[model samples]
Target: MTAGIGHPMETQGSGAPGAGGGAIGLDELDLSIVHALQIQPRAPWTLVGSVLEIDPVTAARRWARLRDVGAAWVDGYLSPAQEDMTWAQLEIAVNGARLMDVVRTLCDDAGVLSLKQTSGSRDLVALVQARDVDTLAEYVSERVCRVPGVQGARVHVITATPFEGSQWRLRSLDAGQRERLRQFDETRPAPGTPVTAEPLRPVERRIAVALGTDGRMPLAALAREVDASVATTRRALGRLLNSGRLALRCNLARPLTGWPVSAMYFASVPAEHLDATATALRTLPELRFCTMTAGPHNLFLDVWLRTLHDVHALEAHISRELGHLRLRVEERAVILRTFKHVGRVLDRHGHSVRSVPINTWK
Candidate 1:
């Protein structure tokens, strides 16, 4: 499975590394550790060390350091089952003085899954989830707009999530390492199957809470957190995995990976060619996030690149290839800072610093 937002493998570093002087630095070994975990997020340190030709204790210590400084992390969240769930992307215009207050209020709401401060006409962007269309309308129209200082709000209902944060990878691992790591990876269910919403049991909720902060938590430790036998916890986890109710993401520090710039594009595409267009865009490695939304601009894309110059090249490529689909660029927004991704809160440098579990049913 791909790493989710903020659920990246820990990279050993002192501080933000790529900025040079004053930023923490990462060596090749640190990168190797990260690549290994990206391939197999829950691999034991001993096994990971063996693959990297290091001692287990050394690997553990390196991870601890990375985790302590918010350099790397792993997180878990419930995936969208085949249920009647509504996912909406919101663009909120807020007063400058009350921006922080508005952000805090939205962040506390369980419906808001991800929040980002961006450079564009909108002051903030939020990804929210609700049970159905009416509930989503209530949250966005009544609740979000009612927040103090929220001057305006635009809601984009996500009709199809062609790609998500979890599918994006660092592509740092070699074929051999990735092949070896796959042996320990868990199996995910095939996509497109109709899934009904099943309320999580109390024990399951506790387990999800524990895993949200650390996807690699030992099964024994997870059992203790939920106050259940290891066997029982493992069985429940297996059920959750088989049902595609829970997802574990292995994410990384993008700055260290030489891809620092992130840009989001909103475009309008012809309805007849929407599926074909989304299918083609999915193959591009640069795309980290893509979704089909119902709004003035129906197609949304988030891409990461090595440099700012690459954005132009990407735009040109899109125009040249999908131009026949009549995809019109509406707006482009550069992510200024990400406060929360998935269920984890990030620092200015895009490090996973903390967790606030998402309640999809809430």
Candidate 2:
């Protein structure tokens, strides 16, 4: 296995690390830990160990390694449909010299969740959520297009996300396999105290991978596939569900349903008043997301709307809220295709055998 290939992937960080910073190397154990967590982030070490048949000490060591390396993190993801909202992806065309500035501004806004600098016709890609079309337009025209350095922008409203996050079940690392991955643990510490009494083994990983691929499989089928009893399979799956690591939801595309106008806009706001300004921006019904960030301009926001009139209303409201903030509308762009979504796993190398109890947050 290559470096960094076996682990659960991390979000691309800022070019520079924060105060205490460094890069993490991937090993076989890290891969196994990641694969198990991917199945259920909240799983207890005891259960994981039991499932894998390893003592708690080894499992704890593996889990700690993954955390230290930043291979995995727990985060929340809510379905837009659950809240009666819509999701969209935006592409912004900006002056190359000011690309970083543009991205920073968008990050500070709350509505904007994730941003990336890309190597295509567009310089930045953003994700935004909104309640309706009018608010989305207001977000674009009044807040985004007017940003000082922006040239243009486009929006591709997300229709559905069939699959997202679930990387652990895809990994295949046993005690022996993990040893092989330790290419150079020169100063690695001697194994320490137990962090938990359970961890997933190779067989458990096999069960997880099966579920990750298809959450709707019948219990009998899953038991047969994983070579476990029906009762055991049910228990394991229940633990995974309670863990917050595995989630299943409906995926739908908006374009196929009739709402097809994907719009983009820009805005320029001042740094000091960015928070207040973004707060006002969110009051509109159309906006799904917004934020403030480090950039030439103070704030960046994105929204998705369906009609021209609604867009006009949202823009007018944003302008009125800014009063004399001297914000300018910049650029907007749309998306035509998606290579991947949130939860799709990037690597598929290993499996686990044991079952573990999961730790879930309320």
Candidate 3:
């Protein structure tokens, strides 16, 4: 959902990411600033500074420094507005030689939220979103399946996302600061809650898209970007933010993070144990996104571990403690590289370079 985030500066400078393509080495303050924005991406400098015990100017400057290096970024993408919207995980088999070409073509498409090359049975894995079942079916049949080098695609519709990335944060923030900075809690909607499906207003659409790349853009700058009065823009923004139709998150480059390795687990939990199994997983700090999918494997887990050895340890830990859940780890894959994630294009080292706006409405 979201990663390390920073507030936008009054001015931005262009440059290559952190030196020599090595570890970002985010220090205490840097991590704290990221945690502040992660908790609330659009938090003002004054609020962040007060809570983090730093000057407003310092907070803004630090955020700019991190952003310039592509160490951290804010991202905004689709939120499930209604029940009809479908989320799918695509395990794609590609012809090896045409890998880059397939990635180039699919990255530009709005529905492909995230696509990455992996080390396993599938050449690629893509997280796709669409308006409805028919829309998703059409996209797969006409667009994805027909792609030149696509050997095959197995689609797993995400039935229930018990946990997601937005709810995560660095342990850098202390209890008091964490408690005080709770403006927006990115909690998942309770089951059976009525979701709104109201259409986005013209100005709202423009504003939402503009924030995808820079979620922490200043209100004044944001107003100018959308070409509307500050008052009009603010009103629209307030509605959109409180509306629960928009998903805004900040992302950090995983390679620079201590937990650099990314892995996926395909597991199945019997109907009776699904809820308890998901609840048990919430205790795992390494778990990123855990979803219930309609496939042979009912649950899919995306995790970040410090090293490859940790993978086996994690699985063993699950098996030892949660044997009663009847969860079976069916298939596993190590993500070699992620070319594009949630619309942001990343460098080889995983630093975000640019973004292709999500075009879900169309």
Candidate 4:
């Protein structure tokens, strides 16, 4: 049971680590550097240089800056079933005084991938990836539960995830706006209207691929892959990120960490009352994901349960809280396998980052 005091707010940022050194603010060059790296983390400097049309040394230095800020990183995503592993998310409630201490231990766990200190009923949320279901149970039942002053720890096994990550869609930004993007290097601007339904181009697609692979490639290296100049590549990335098209961050699946149960809760609310109902569900401590979709059921909540009992309790709690509205439970389909992610089909899309393949770099 997650026990906390404050209401949960809708706030999310890139989960990937940022450059730790506060040497200087970001600029267009840094963004370009990130864009190129995400597509091809291991790409050669010579190839990247060609993409940015700059020499190798310049590209390397820019990449170093991005890394220093913890803005981006690259790592392999080992499949859970194939790798003989199990994963889950741990939602914990702790006294405010011991929050940091608990978080420190949680972060130190070898199995833990990502940890977030959040508001609402739970003080800390963690994504744990382990070798097997047994490992997941031990990590939560023994290691995490042993923390001092811990009220409770909830673990949820992730059966399947239809979508995750920051949802980086670079389909917005026209050529001109993209050109202007090279001027600013920050990850995102203040909140604005969502940008969808726009067309994407070749360079943008390549940049997205590059960032998908590395998120921290040197400008020269990135340029070589896309066959563009460092100046041009940097501008394109800046535009993509600042405009919220491409997100450069680490996406560690919760299953990788150990909490594995995946369930969706549907609440029936009348049209006029939808807003309030959604607001209430958002405040729920166990609800990690919520959405207002187009269907007979307007409100949907995605939750990860630590144990079988918690699963029943979660549903019961929702029913008790919103029973007046006639809530419904729609079980989410288990993820037997994941063939594609972030637009990259592991088997098919891995080879080509662009819609049309061009051998210009070679």
On TM-score, the leading prediction is 3
TM-score of 2: 0.43
List the candidate 3 regions with Cα displacement exceeding 4 Å: 1-24, 80-84, 184-202, 227-229
Better of 1 and 2 by TM-score: 1
C-alpha TM-score for every candidate: 0.85, 0.43, 0.87, 0.45
- TM match of model 1 to true structure: 0.85
Q: Is candidate 3 or candidate 4 better by TM-score?
A: 3
Worst 10 residues of 2 by lDDT: 346-355
The root-mean-square deviation over C-alpha atoms between each candidate and the true structure, in angstroms, is 5.0, 20.4, 6.2, 16.1
* Candidate 3 least-lDDT 10 residues: 2-11
lDDT per residue (tens digit) for residues 243-293 in model 4: 444544432222321233444544456766666665566545445555454
Which candidate, 2 or 4, would have the higher TM-score against the true structure?
4
* Candidate 4 TM-score over all chains jointly: 0.45
The alpha-carbon lDDT assigned to residue 343 of candidate 1 equals 74
- Overall lDDT per candidate, in order of appearance: 0.75, 0.46, 0.77, 0.49
lDDT per residue (tens digit) for residues 132-215 in model 1: 899888888799999999998889988888777776665556688778777774333345544445666777777766787788
lDDT of 3 at 341: 81
Best-fitting candidate, scored by lDDT:
3
Give the lowest summed-lDDT range of ten residues in model 4: 353-362
Candidate 1 ranges with C-alpha deviation above 4 Å: 1-22, 80-84, 185-202
